[model samples]
Target: MWWQAAGILLGAVLGAEVLGRAAGWGALGAGSREGHRVAVTFDDGPSERTPALLAVLARHAVKATFFVTAPASERYPALLRALGVAGHQVEAHGRWHRHALLLSPWREWAQVRWHPRAGGAGPHLYRPPYGGHSPLTRLFARLNRRQIALWDVEGRDWTAEQATTLAARTLERTEPGSVILLHDGPGVTPALLDALLTGLRDRGLEAVTLNDLPTRRITFWAGLWRLASSYGA
Candidate 1:
């Protein structure tokens, strides 16, 4: 009897993973690789460090997308306004930073439903925290009319001890159509962004917002690879 119950539980877990992967196919992780365009996106911010990050982006004349948490948006309405004023695309990163997989069904629904009051009109996008998705994550996105935005490249700036090294490594990984993932809350991000922008310029890659990036739905295997590589599957 115990073995039968264990088999059922295992089957359920595998079933969820399969469905989640299928649902994630519609998500945009990278744009077409034919052009020299990339999108630079920042997550979890509007923090005190965001002003400096904004300055760096401004200096480079690059417009990036910021996937901001609802709590941060509420705490720093001015920063949210500033993001819009600066021509950056602001989207929802969720109600909180917790991964969707860790939340209950109701909480996950609320997470996708919660958008900043300062967010603009239609065509909203949502990026789950840690790029983690539950079985129903895509269903919630559909109900809320939000497109799930995932990244193809990660800067991993949060783990870096120095901005220069992080920027160099990130630049090495970035290519055409890369949706680069960086964070706005980290102290090193400002400098890292500066160096990254400069490197992108040197490599002849233009950094643009997701709207400008000529995106396409991620291929099934590509999306699976991205999830596995970035979030350890």
Candidate 2:
């Protein structure tokens, strides 16, 4: 009897990881396939490094989406405003930088509901920290009318790899309609951003904000692919 109960619990966890977390059921993880375009999104920001990141984006004449944490946005209201002023989409990354899978249901609800005071007008997009989801994460998002945003290509700028190497790898994996995940707090990100933009230009792929990206629902197969590719990444 004990073993049966344990097995049931294990199955539930695995199912949640596959369907709710990996498959990202009912979430928008990628864009339409009809264009030479990708959306670049940065999370955990309004940091000191954001200004440099913004400068790089400006130099490329590109717009992007930033999922800024509540604490960070509150700490650096001016930088948050600067993101909006620069014509970039500002969205929510949660009140804290904790993973949704690790949060209580009530806390998770608050996380989904909380928005920055200075967050500019945009679609209700929320990217849970680490792209994780608990049993209630999607339900909370829907109740709050927030669409969970996940990425197809991860920039991995947070790693120790040099900017050029990161850029090359990211370019190799990127395809049309890919949503790239990068962070604003990493020191290497600005350089990586520069190199990535240049490479996108070379490939004739336009980098745009998620709001501007022509998007579609994340299919089951596509979500499985994303989940498989995310491991050790």
Candidate 3:
């Protein structure tokens, strides 16, 4: 039984690694830094809240990565430009936050690959809507050469009826390499960024931009998304 359990664990790890390489679903590994380093990632955004969040980040002198939807970015293209100027990393979060669990890898690749908002090529990273995961999804990401990043901490900002309480608790529980999840959708305003940014500062954590780290050069899948850098477009 113990051997079986070990085998499963090993398989999952190896499988994820192989799938990540094969599908381009991995990220820069050296990102884990000294001190309590952590990453803040927002999803489904470039919304009205995005501007507010940008201001807060600027004031606090911090940066956070945004995994934005194509349409939302298209709707607020200027905000996308601001995010870039602020030195934040822009990543792909699918065309919209729709479900595609049963989607084939190729279709998933094309959906994100061709998004005009994404500036043509898919990003090196992708976080599925609602944390959705599957082998096909992984495969597609690998084929596109993107990473399927899962989070370590989530503020549940979408359920922000009482965001303050949740945000505070999240800070108290975070550790190094923690990926904090936020939202920039309709109800998820940039107003919520204050608490999160404050929490990070109080704890003496440095927020990082993807550009701060060297790009993971998995040449086996490098050129898959040539335009992943069309972040501001």
Give the per-residue lDDT digits (tens) of candidate 1, residues 1-233: 99999998677655555435433577877898899999999999889988998899999999999999988988999999999899999989999899776899999999998887425686888888987777688889999988888787789988946999999999988989999999988888998999999999999999999999956788777756755764665
- The candidate that wins on lDDT is 2
RMSD of each: 2.8, 2.3, 9.6
TM-score of each model, paired residue for residue? 0.89, 0.92, 0.70
* Cα lDDT of model 2 by residue, 1-233, tens digit: 99999998678767766777677766887888779999999999999999999999999999999999999998999999999899998888999899876788799899999876425454588889988777678779888878888887899998999999999999998999999999999999999999999999999999999988956678878776767765743
Model 1, global lDDT: 0.85
Candidate 2: segments with Cα more than 4 A from true spot: 1-9, 117-122, 228-233
Error of 2 at 73 (Å): 0.5
Q: Give one digit per residue, the lDDT tens place, for model 3 in 166-231.
A: 777778756665567788764544555677778777887766654453334334333233224212
Backbone clash count for every predicted candidate, in the order shown? 0, 0, 9
What overall lDDT goes with each candidate model? 0.85, 0.87, 0.64
> Can you list the residue pairs that collide in candidate 3?
23-141, 23-142, 23-143, 24-142, 24-145, 24-146, 25-146, 25-147, 26-147
Q: Can you rank all candidates by TM-score, best first?
A: 2, 1, 3
Model 1 residue 207 CA deviation in Å? 0.6
lDDT of model 3 at position 154: 71
